[model samples]
Target: MTPHNELRLLPWSGPDGKPCFLLSTDGPLSRLAGLTEAAQLDIAADLLEHAHEVLADESSAPEELRLVPSDLTGALGDALRVAASRGHRLPTPGTSDHGDSNEVPHLPAGAFG
Candidate 1:
């Protein structure tokens, strides 16, 4: 069994659309993991381009305008996950020890729900 404490960044999401992660000791990246990461980055890149285009369009619909923020934010989060998987550890939000006591507020469970 995979060790419970060994960290692994998940490349896909749960059935409810939430991101999922795993725990496994130092092992080679699985074929599925590699493929998933590539696919996710590709999709994110496409979405980013689409989001920029939507923002640039003078005649964008109200719905498209509303989508821009969520789309961009989601892409950024995905990119962060990919970066984390490559061994760049992101500091835990509230654990920053720079004497800044203002904790970053956690977002509500769902996006704009």
Candidate 2:
């Protein structure tokens, strides 16, 4: 178990729809975290089929078209965060090294902003 002062990976997003990596000890993850993980996986799985459908339908609503990509991106982002933290390979097989520190470029702090 990680110490209380140490950072722990929470399986959810923060208030602003970003991954919520927070500090934790031996305490269990929040209910919201579990719900968010399940929801993200569900969205990811459904997007596989639904995205095709939306693309094939010419009459697809603008809202539907707009949301699918946004949601899919969010789902993929969450999955990437979890996988990166766990040092696990991504779902799709690729030549990229999932756990190679040398291969992965290290970004400076506050790079996102």
Best by TM-score: 1
Could you give candidate 1's per-residue lDDT for residues 1-113 as a string of tens digits?
23345466677678998767665533465557767778879989898888889989899999988988887787787778888776633445574545677586678779677
Query: Over 4 Å off in model 2, which ranges?
Result: 1-7, 13-27, 30-36, 88-113
Tens-digit lDDT track of model 2 for 37-73: 6776777788868888998999999999999899778
State TM-scores per candidate. 0.56, 0.48
Residue 48 in model 2: lDDT: 67
| TM-score, candidate number 2 | 0.48
What is the lDDT for 56 in model 2?
Answer: 98
lDDT of each: 0.72, 0.65
Runs off by more than 4 Å, candidate 1: 1-6, 13-29, 88-113
